[model samples]
Target: EGRRRGSRAEGGAAFETARCPLPPAVPDLLGRDAELARLRAEAAADAPGGVVVSIVGHPGVGKTTLAVSAAHELASRYPDGSLAVDLRGTDDRPLSPRAALEQLLGALGLPARQIPASEPEQSQLFRSLLAGRRVLVLLDNAADEAQVRPLIAAAPGCLTLITCRRALAGLETARWVWLDPLEAPAAADLLSVIVGPDRVLAEPEAATELVALCGNLPLAVRIAGNRLATRPNWSIAYLAGQLRDERTRLSSLSAGDLQVRSAFEMSYGLLSPSARRVFRRLAAIPGSGFGPELAGVAAGMSAAEVQVRLDELVDVNLVQAAVIPGRYQLHDLLRIFAGERLEAEEEAAERSARSEELLSYLLRTATIAGRAFDPPVLTAHPFASLDEAAEWLYREASNWRAAQRRAAAAGRHREVVDLAIAMHWYSDGRTQQQPWDEIFALGAESARALGSRREEAALLNFLGWARYFCLGDNEGGRAAHEAALALAVEIGDRTEQAWANASLGSVLTRMGRPEEALEHARRAVDLSGDLPFWLGQGSIRNVLGTILRVLGRPGEALEVHRGLLADIEKHYDEAHPFARRFFHSATLQCIGLAQNETGDWPRAAETFRRARELFGEGGNALEEADAALNEGRARREAGQYEAAAECLRAALRGFTGVAAWWPRARALAELSTVHWLTGDAAAARRYRDEALALCEELGTPQARALACELA
Candidate 1:
């Protein structure tokens, strides 16, 4: 340790002796072992002049702590001395490069009179002093590249470590290390360090919850830990329960001077007015992640303008760029802070207007995207292609779904009904029925409230399909379809009547009542006769063919399905490719079923394969899985056990990926059969056990049948 000593220059001005003034390394530096090791390695690496390492991250992310810790660890490598200084970059009054040079000169043993007044002269003198000597300089809380540029020591054997909240992209020669919030394990370990290990061990679940509530941020965890430590009477669970309130979370994460909010405020204060406005307005959006387009719509800015503003926010770590390109998200705590700022800075009316605008935009865009799957109802929209429309619908689902809820709450029933109606055909391709259940239920209620029986019947038909196919609730589906048919007949809405009859026929067929299903299916085809194939007639015919096959009329079912395919080909247009593919795949699967019933296993396998490919092209994961299941069944009937097992496994994967528990259970049963036939007794038993468990949970007729078979 080089101790400071009083010295006088030739001109009689006194200065303190050059000394290693680095602060003591943090005793419990958790969650930064890899970062510290990398810093040490870089410091020890060979360089012509010196190495400059810049540690960058958001405020309260422990950038300065890491820099200081690394400096202390590598202190012995530099024989001359180590120096540390705080630039106070986030303050209203940041230290200038010239003033920073004055401090560094004093620290380097220069007398006050000998230190040059000009920045360039001082920089040159500082470099000259450290020319041949190995010294470590730690510049903490830097404002920008400009403030840090002059302070860099260019002498050989001198190492400089700089830390800042923002990335100093303008700094050319420095190696950069980015810091993110601590991972859960490391963050919990840090919390355990501050609060006693025994206390954390006693309430492990609360400790995990506490860290997650802190967003695994190091400073928040430290403050929370310190608060728990000071109040010996407070349990970890008690403290966690207190932090659960978002309104008071920031205020709660405080111990003495360590406050998460104050650290965030410093970063927030540095943003431009426009950037700040965008930042706060973003909190009004309903989802965690969004793109520039949504941000632009919310902020009332153009795409270009919002992109520039978003870049500005990302520079300061206020917003993070998502792994998916063109997407960004604010940190959980930052989002809360932004929401607080929005309420504080914006008027009530202005905030309401902004939120309403975003909601309206989301709902309108969603309606347009959903319409891409329904070709006959063409409307002017932003999307250029079906793929783009599908992407937007799935990617922005949370936002649009939130908008639907808001619209319902605000009594905007027409808008809610319109969005739900558009999602009718679109929901068929989605992975789960839960979202569709909520959407169609709200739509049906809104339609009922508005006295629009036709819309209500249509929405109820959709709800029925979701219940029967997606949810595997035959009774619920039959009830919905019956209600929808009653409403449709009362309103003389033939289209809705056709949909209701078709849905009811499918549900009845699944309930092992094909004789009753045949009557409803034929009536659906008749009711849909005036409509085009892509509209409703093709689906009705497919239902009719399926009922015929189930009732032991495979020859008639084959003719019906072939005729339906011919009708589709005759009326197909390239403009409505998704609708065409969807209908074509549906017809092919019916044809495959008829073929399977007629003992044409090879033809059925080929037809199912084609249907699976078509469904895949239409982005219908559930339908594709259905085709695979059918193909596996056909292959098994043909005595192709190995091929059938592969097909069943593929079907299982598709079902599991979409969380379609009923279909997954069905696939598991099919796999068990194939495994049993192939002499894999253990695998067969395992598959049967899983299928029975799923069936026991589902409590559906099909599940009960499968369970009986497994038993």
Candidate 2:
């Protein structure tokens, strides 16, 4: 009786209580009675959040048949209806979790546009939609735990059945059912059901021999039966004799054109010349799966052409279609088959050319995507819009990341350097989300190989930045920046020199060496020379202002930030809003911190509010939390204890969301100060103790100061 709102297109979001209309169950499945009984018992005993029952077997086994039969028999128990999906687990291109979610949601009446872009967000939304609903979700041929995890219902009354070739041992909650090839009786029974029990009974010995020849697999047995059904005159002995050869067993398991190889060859033969070329070339890709767009690059066709051919291949099951549109995968045997064809038909030069083309396409597309976040590159670019670029980056992340490593191994040093350099700004926000040291390390090595000193210096600087800010390796950062400085000095690249000094200053500040940091910051500012407001000068100034504040000259820091902000306002290019907002937020945060230091509490609060807004607008959650913490500090200094507590709590929430422990600890300390000001000694002590412990664990300066104060 439950109802859900449809998307806007479906009658203005009216509720429609509906259930998944599962496909008809396969008929006459043999040797699965025990497995079926086990599945039903488990489903009945499943917890409120549901249970995952994974049916694992080799490819061409009867796993899918058993799952469908079980779901049909147990349909009445789940009134909310049953859903099923093919995950293409045995194929190189298995379905993506996000795409699987989209299908589930679509079946539940949500439209494509309504689905969230990110997998995490989509998963949350899907879970919320399924809350309290009793549903049977059958995920067939799932690739791994990751693909199935997001689709498993959390509702109490739901049951999820998964089928895959591998055991998926990583899914700890799953109940395992390993399907071995059918026993002799079951295999003979399955063939009899497909052909006819009378025919099978008439030649029991031949039937048994034929089933044995088919490897006792349901798919092979069914195909063998199908072949015999069409040729009623052929004796079971004749068929068994035809399949006796092990090498040609698969080839002989055909009825006319329905032969195993014929089934594949027919689909392969039907492909347009270009699609066949791409399909075989794809076997050369190292990754297990690839997106449709990449298939175009591999085939030397346009995106539109690749999609059409991929669909044709999927139609005949030559290629397994992923739940996510635009993704296609081949089964292990199919990939091997494709490789055989590729080796036999294609020239070495042709294979190498296709591989290089794919690499080039991935490199170019990655550069375009990364440019969306980098100020200097995005200022006047026209290849892709920001949204398209960002979408491409996420949707094709695996493709390009693999390509980067492959190209590096192939000694495409210049291309690798170009790709890594383009990611400079984009990498800043993803320090924790990605392992960037590998990319930058390879880039630096490639730059050195190419004898490009400027590229090497930039790569080293980026490497150092990631180490300091993301990994907390201050010593590693210091070494890399020193190398960058040495190289910049030798090459006489003033821009790189400024960047090296500014980057070093930032690292030094974090290491608590304010005086040495100040020396670098001042030189960075002097060398920058106003190339463009946010490009180099603004960056150097922001570090300079921070160093001045730590040196206990808040008045001077405030003066520096004030002048920088005015200059930025005059020269700020609105062309790349994302980059502009990031640079401006840093300025506002510095100015607000300086004001807080000078006891301009009210002004500081206002400045922090602006900085928080800027950070939020730019999607910088960590920086936004820091801004909120500063605002709280300003309010606490102004004696507005209640408001200070509220602001600090907001900062705490933001920090927790991003798991920024250091900032979270600072917010706790600020809340402790607010409690003390409000005369709550017990509350103040509790908060202070927690903050002190966290700071000690983190080895922050706050720990030392708090220890001295307590003593």
Candidate 3:
């Protein structure tokens, strides 16, 4: 009953009754139950002054629809009347406070001639009219706090709900409610309602994908639903496939006047020119989110200036702050819109140049960060500390990964190979192995394309490590190392040959062929003897020690490992801090393994614990997890069940965090053994079952062997 009704007088002004001009509630409004409840509760709450609540979000997020619906539901509480007005906040000219007061006055049955001349006077007169009345004032699409402040009623019983694209945080007295895109299920339900439930039910997978392609924004979903509903003959999958292309996604989201692009255009048109430039250029960034430093590079602005522009964009809902502080992201649909603007307004040469600038910055910065983990003392770099370097590497990983791909695609072979080679040592400590596989594959291809045999051999060795250690592909690792060794020999690159031989030794050791692995390990050691400390000698020694331990020569392995540690200590002062910690940790871990094979459980446990601490200090999460596993095994053998369980759990956490399924499975199996030893059969069974499931999923030799032992 929020409709305006009365007979028109001779002057054509309606002889208004108690005014209720609220729009019709959207029937079965989906995905806003929580918001509606909060709005209604705020409206009903008693305050000294009238209650004012602002609903804020990006364009096409249904702020107006929600305000209208809330107003209609809460109309009964405001028995005197309810009034609504569109402030056109996203328009070229937003409604001024004076104009807004005039509209409210007219809605309250005041004649045009009787309205006050000044905005302050009009606001006073308007509040005076509603002083004792229980009215709901709905200011739809408010431009800012200034436009809303003057219009709020002074009566304590009154409630004013203002909706805007901006947050209007300056309204200190108002309670704020922010809207994100609908949740996936709610979005799917909304689509199900718009398209027949039967159709959605028939193609549930496609329906889910279609709503996701819509970015879960209500308006976009409704538009897609309408398009699908009208095209009865078209399958939902076909429509989803059409929208999958980012180049035409916005175009496909349009159905008549209901255009997602048009909705974005209105908000975009309101941005300052500089903000507009930054917003569009940000589409060049590859990942879902990016930090201010990268944005600064893209916009050619100082970080401080870029932050200011980012705040401006955030206020208007053009950009959103990510879960991580200081990072921002554009909505999927909005990113597409920005890309469209980038192509349309920017010159092709200019776009290419800007893209190259960003890519160059990403690669160069990544190289610097990666070097912090490499051998020898780290040279002068922008990062002030090892932790800062690591943080930048992980945070900007997506951006730099994309840059690598783009560079490779553009045939910038030298740059791609350089980045890949720089990341070799850094990749060892990374959380996931898959990224290294992709990176090294590109590096190898680029090196081959450039006909740089030395680089090719080096990248091939790195690729072998990735396949063997990261991916658990032993045969693939063996093949890659063999190929690298052949190339190294062909070119007479002794350092590359040494690394290739050591990599082969490690892979062969894992393949259950310690004898064959010993040959490779010994050859690698011989080759490494004449090379520099950082040129594979130290690493080759570690590989040799691991092989010696596997071949039932723990005493010899211990000797070799001790010698490696002694050598590392001599050059310790010359190594980067991260390299020092990481190498010491690695060597200690090898010594611990040898100690364990020699049945010195106590010493092995202590060594592994120290290695774990060193790995943690070096920020090598996966290696820390490995150290934890080793410690747990030693502790179990030493009859410390409680300590073993604790260490194993820590290992599980580290493995799970990195999504290292094989290692996680091993941790689970170890926990199962610990639990069984502690007389917890059910716990043991549960852990064993979980481990077996993962083992089956991995299908690796080690995984299968563990699975069989448990079975």
Candidate 4:
């Protein structure tokens, strides 16, 4: 890092290059002979006077020791005494310029009365005193640029060295140096200092192994070395005993005057109690990053208070202030510490209850916001907290999933049994709502946990329908529906009973069991009237239309769709919250198909157009594509050749799956007629073959006839 950034100073005492001293005593920095030589050379060169050098890296990386060593080596060149200030940049009470300069001036034997009161006057006085006298100013544990800037003595004879846990890039005058982990040989050398050089030299392999376990962090290694240095009776192999235990691995980093936690605790203890409380709770948050809004939620504090606490944590190096914007995270080491404290500091039962409440709050919020996203239903247990609930779900989607997973793993069977019930809207909202797979797995797990035939049956039935219709997973669709049917029979829940019947009917229809599917649809309709109208009435009626159309009873299907359409129009406006949902759009598509099958081509075209418009509103690519295919089919049958050509081109662009391909092929065959009628035989022939291939591929006899006619 020194070579990367430091400019080489010309001849003269490099220490005259104006360096700062670190604290009075610092040991355990060894094996940087080549590194120290480079720094010493830069310090000697007089290319630029008043140069500020900063030492920066992760904690326990030996930045202070290197800076302090350089400061002591440079002491002889400066007749005036060197000054060391613990700026505490990452800690609370970043040493203010007034306090630091007062200490520096007083240390040099200047009377307290002689020092100026304000920051500017004191800065000038300090510079005046050090003007001709060569001095080294080592600002140790410096916080940030704002803390260190005022303390810079403006004399060419004074060299300034600042050490911090972070790169003080904000200080324009500072040359940056990074204190990375000591290398293996260097760490071994550091270990030698604790256990004598000869002992480490004898067991180089063990020494190498020890450093690897240390993560090459100076703080952790020093603790290991200290254990060996003080306890001569403890063998190197015996020290390795404690190291083998994962639980107590970081324990080695604990001892008198040198502990990672103690260092952390000292900084933590300095915080206001409120900040400490917020600090620990922040660990309970699930994501790797969080916004201030989430921090506000986790702390149950005001936005202003959360920001203040965040700043406090950043100042003390407990939390890193997110550099991008509106985010924060604990460092890995600090995260471990904070997590441990969260569990230990709070009663286990109390923490567990709070976690449950937080998870319930998230589930309730997600369901509400999801409903509001399109208000498709008034589920029996609709969420009460609307606005606040929506806001929370929008913020903590990931946390809710993590919580759901954690609950399931802990054998909290009840939680597992019903987590997906809380998140029902996830699958219902369609594939665009990402987190669908997670919601499905959670709901399935919850059903497994409950082992209640009724709940399991309902979940299986509903989840199966969603997978088949939305995700288009045929195997999952079949298995889930089968499970629902068997469980519904076992539970005897009439609503789920009818739902299971309808679910099997649809999957069976997709599997080409039209006759059997027609029987199930009939059974679903028979059971529908005894249940709630909204629960299965609309669905069963649609199923009836589907079966009738398959039986070539277009007249009956058209009549069913017409009546359902009237009910929808009479009870709800176009902007009715639920009417705007994708479910309503799907119903509209069935209505359009019924009309087209019954020979009301104009009405079919209009209904398809309306459905397409509705899907477009939500940017639902899949729905819009299906609607385009239907509108094209209606246009083709209406003998609107030019219009049909336009519609089919759009359908091809928008359609996705098998259903779409069949309609699109029919439209293509019709469009070839348009070409043949317009005296473009070559274009007609090309389109005819394309349509034939699609028909053969999809096994559409009706479309194949049109292709053959065009040929």
Candidate 5:
């Protein structure tokens, strides 16, 4: 997928990438220095309708070559990153705007769950993610204006370079840089680069004839150069004789599918059956990408068998499997001609049916596997195949993820939601936010169309969780949560309501209304009592416990927490790492707070020590810092001034580099008391004042009081 950033056609490489930058080498670059400069000058915009450079040309006129080169020239200026996408505009299907955005989000390293399911949200997010980053985006092989708009970035300091066969020169502020055929001299230079200078120098007359016959197209000239380099004994005059015939002239460069069949046949007729089969079957792909699948469907062979055939094709330079671990596309002109062969020389219905079959197979598998991971709550399916379902979902994640957006274009909402939910397990580092986000967005539309408020509630609930927990957009999170809750109430689905409650609790937590968050959590837990595997329960308890301790209700909170810990150790899998840590943390914090409130300061300090150790085991630095802060306070209140200083310093050591923002104030406050006790009244006053300043800045009430009244 030569997947570049920003645009959508290509596969996304994971957003926020840190790969080795493109090397100094750039190829097929011609006559664009002035165009490049003009583009750079017009790249910036404070608002929408920024400079969109469209390089239009006929097929095989080197549009992509120039686009890539121009983007390369402008790469360093955009520090955030650069992106590229090949819109499949030339073939039967064109790239959808949402699919393109999804790929771009992945390449940009946006989270998979964060991708919006709706086109508008995807576009909005595409712009938002690009808003502050200085990135150069190249959209190559685009079909039309509608396909390009959603992926366009209008942010200042960001530039967009688009290459299409048609001139969308009408778009505002878009500088059109049309790539005509290369000049004979430039074509001659390129030919020289491929073949020996001596070969060109030896046949100047024939070389001029050759360039003329190629329509001065770079791809054609390059193919001619390759043929010449290999056939050292063949004279240019002999080649010219073959080229003089228009019937065989373009065919002279064709090696079957390697170049263009006419061009390739001109080149390919020189090869055997092995190469021809490789070219024809490769052209039969339904998707832009190919692997063993095309060889299986088109050539009626397995992956391993196709590899041997593909190797022969690659050896003759008829195929370029550059899409590591997958087969690749033939060149634009070449694919066009091969497709023509597939139409005339092969059965049309068979190929079309095969294409549909492949896509359907992908969707069905994606749906089943997706349902396995996140099965419908009220559905009749028991969701029992633990291994097969999960295995299938994991294996076909890419196809289903792609299918959700693909189906959305045709308004297939059920497939969109079903497919996205199946991909829950691997929705982490790879892929991106737009794919799933758009899935839910479309699912919302689909639910409305079907008049299924329950479905709408579920989609909104998923969207709410995604926005709240993944992206940290509190207002959006709150709205989505409310929307989900209202819809759930309308449908009278208690389970959906339960999820919405948990989601609302999350938003309230972020909104700093912990009291409301606790109430919401308690309601969700009560609703979840009859349900199975409510993962959110533990998370809710963790939040509620923290809130209660913060609100000075440690006694009530401890009784609830002790039972939770006991239940975790008894009914839950204690061998699970997360389970062990959760129980350890709840036990330690609740007990520590209760003891501290009851004036058993030594017991409070000891309990905090255990919590700190457990967090250290979990590699949870922030939680460890919290534990240390608690013990430091207990020590200071107990009048163990030196120990209090030691505990605060230890907390600082763990939190100094990390953003332990809330605990930093407490650590400073405890440290100031030590200073006051150690006979340094000036230092104590200074530390106290500094702590108060930090507390005020972060809006932490207790830290402010401690700093103002104590040390």
Candidate 6:
């Protein structure tokens, strides 16, 4: 009958139904009757509205098999024919959204030359073709939400069924059906269907154990069944016992070319050499997931190139896209398989070289990102925009931080010290009360290992600031700074000595030793005077001014800030707007704090407003929020309740968005006070409770004290 139909079609080419390009119907799909029935019901119920059913599961739970079975059963009902595409959601070369659309349009009888190149235009034409037609579109193995969203049947009287490892959370309209491993009864039934039912019934208990040993997963079961069917003499009990060992389970599941490892290898083999290297080395990443930028550094490739490879990996199901947009992860089993490949395929020296490349990239790139937060020095800025720098710092935090540990293990002491030196100022604000204490401690150890007194002194100086500001360990901070001062004096590094003195002054002030703090602040200023270090003088003076304000000497603090502002303006260059804005904004914020302390409410508010503008332009969200917080406090002091609440709310939003916990807590506390002043007791209590919870969670003494005061 098929031969007669082929001959007739050849004679009457015009009468053939344009050859629906659906793949051959799946030969046998056992124990999925309910799933198929659900799809049929959805397709029938969703007439004229269009139905999109997503069959999501882990690797090889038979997603493609189930979709194909449903398509074959429901094809006759849709008179307009069906279209099936292997979007290769898990392929190394997944089809692009645009290309997928073009293929679908071509299947709909559109000519190649007439199809639009742009995605939007192609989508419009596709929807037009699908309109008023009861066609079924089966999109198998979707890579991510973005890849499948465009292919969804746009008009009613159609159905689009997609299968993928990920949940594709971004696809809002699609009804999701999550598939797990088959149950014991169903698993045995499937095994029987594949390898003769009589053979399975002959040893029922052994068949049940065999299915369980296969993890009740359809793919494993099918392979096991195929292997047994070919070897007619092999007993079911013998095969089940062979797969009992966990280590050799993957090996035992395979018979010929049909293998779990081979399916994984097919995806891996399609990768470019660079991408393959990245995929295998990714086993070294300690966490479950990572972004492409970090993967790029590990692979020694550009971020753009790594992103394309990541898309390919996602398409083939070797990697899964995370809920966080840029992050990707491997399944636990796949991760182990990748590690096996890395050990077998890569030499020890090659692995070490890859580690070195990753470490060096992290140290260099992190230093560049970190320096963007510092007051302008004479050094060239590595990043073109502060926004780019901030994003890099946030997104790649895990990669660079992990690299620091790896560097320490490899004895790359000098790079470790230099990396931490760059983070000195940036860490103070960005990670205040975060885990920067351990980072600085590592830097100090690295410096000591190199036997460089100057580097040791510098690391110790930064370590003191981290202990005092971030860890709230005043004793540790004083001890570290004193050691740094001793080392600097012994080495005749006057610049480092001055920086150490300035750091000690800040620590002593926080420790309630005002007179001692004043002495150190004066020495820091005196020592910095003759230093040729570009940022030294202003850095020490800023510390001096801050101490004076802390000691109730606001008038002197104001004078010192005014002098520091003038010096910054004197050196400011119009061509280097980042440097200019960086210096000016910090100075303005300090001046605002000084004015607020002196009871000059209006001047403080105005200064804070100007600082906020500069920080906003520079893309310093944390600093911008700081200015807003200060302005809110000044307005509150002036009894401008409404204005104060508005400023505090804006500050809270910014701080919350960036996850700056300590400052977010502070903003919440301040906002509570503003609400209290405005007689909104409910709002005040709500904000106060949030602040108290955050303070308690962090276990910071200063934050706790502030929270108590609010209570």
Best candidate (score: TM-score): 2
- lDDT, candidate 2, equals 0.74
Residue 242 in model 6: lDDT: 64
Which of 1 and 5 is the better model by lDDT?
1
Instruction: Report the lDDT tens digits of candidate 2 across residue range 73-174.
Output: 987888876887666565556767876775676566654343443466456656655666787888887888888888998778888899887888998678
Per-residue lDDT for 551-574 in model 1, tens only? 999999999999988988788774
* Candidate 3 structure quality by residue, lDDT tens digits, 1-711: 000000011001222433336766787578899999999789878987899999988767788778888888888898888887667565434666766675677666654333443466566556656766788888887888888888887678999898887889999779999998889999899998888999999999999988877777787777677666766887889878767755554444434222466445545656789999899999898765698889999888888999999998887667888645798877655777788889988999999888889999988888778887665535455688777987888777768888899899999999999999888766654514125677999999999999999999989988887777655578998998999999999999988888788888878888889899889888888888787774567878888888888889999999999998898879877766766687788889989999999999989999999999998987677788899999999999999999999999999987765445677898999999999999999999999999998787667678899999999
Show the lowest summed lDDT stretch of 10 residues, model 5. Answer: 1-10
TM-score of decoy 2? 0.70
Residue 126 C-alpha lDDT in model 1: 67
Tell me the deviation in Å of residue 318 in model 4.
4.9
For each candidate, give its TM-score against the true structure.
Answer: 0.58, 0.70, 0.60, 0.53, 0.62, 0.58
Alpha-carbon RMSD to native, per candidate: 23.9, 9.3, 23.0, 22.7, 9.4, 17.9
1 versus 2: better lDDT goes to: 1
Report the C-alpha lDDT of model 5 over 1-711, residue by residue, as the tens digit: 000001111122234533212323346565556666766666544435445778887766776766777677777888888777767787666667876776676567643433544566567657755765777788878888888888887777778888888898557667787776777788887777777788889889888877767767776676776787788898777776766675654444433222233445556666666556556656755455566654564566677877787776665566666433464555555567666656655677776665565556667766665554332321333445645655545434544555555667767666665655554433421233334455566777677766777878877876665565545467887798788888887777887777777767767867888788778767776766654432444545544565566567877767766666666656555234543574467467767887787788987888898888887787666567778888888887888877878888888666543434346666777788789788988888887787776666555466567656653
What is the lDDT, from 0 to 100, of the residue 462 in candidate 4? 56
Worst 10 residues of 1 by lDDT: 1-10
Error of 1 at 586 (Å): 3.1
For 193-293, candidate 6 gives per-residue lDDT tens digits of 88899999999999998886666778767767766786789889877776665444444433421235544553565567766777888777644358887
Whole-model lDDT, candidate 6? 0.73
Candidate achieving higher lDDT, 3 or 6: 3
Per model, how many backbone clashes are there?
0, 4, 1, 15, 38, 8
Model 3: lowest-lDDT 10 consecutive positions: 1-10
Model 4 / residue 213 / CA error / Å:
13
